[model samples]
Target: MKRLLEFLGFLAVLQGVMGLVHEFADWNVGVVGRIGFLDGYEVYASVALLALGGALFAVAESRRSA
Candidate 1:
């Protein structure tokens, strides 16, 4: 379970970073247009993913510590 959570967390963080780069770096994540609103998608996604990753990591760490 810990390993799975860690893996999922890492994946989420990686995806979030990709989305952020796509949104802010003038890169297209898909066929989508590049605009502020579009960029916000990346921002929001990154934040959510980072949060999830952090949560998972914390949970795993706490479990191990216990």
Candidate 2:
């Protein structure tokens, strides 16, 4: 669970960063436009994924400490 959380957290952070870069910087690293993926939706998805990842990480740490 801990490993899974860590991995998920990292991926979420990466997704957020990518979204930011694609939205503000106008630089799509992956098949964003080619695959018909929109940055407008990415921003919201990024927030949700990041929040979920953070919560998972916190829960994992708390469990480890307990």
TM-scores vs. true structure, each candidate: 0.69, 0.69
Q: Runs in model 1 with CA error above 4 Å?
A: 29-40
C-alpha local distance difference test of each model: 0.68, 0.66
Candidate 2, residue 51: lDDT: 81
Error of 2 at 41 (Å): 2.0
> Clashing pairs in model 1?
none
Model 1: worst 10 consecutive residues (lDDT sum): 30-39
Cα deviation of 21 in candidate 1 (Å)?
0.6
Which candidate ranks first by lDDT, i.e. highest? 1
Candidate 1 C-alpha error for residue 12, in Å: 0.9
lDDT of 2 by residue, 1-66 (tens): 677777777777677666656766878653332334653576676666668778877867776632
lDDT score, candidate 1, position 49? 73
How much is 65 displaced in model 1, in angstroms? Answer: 8.6
Model 2 score (lDDT) = 0.66
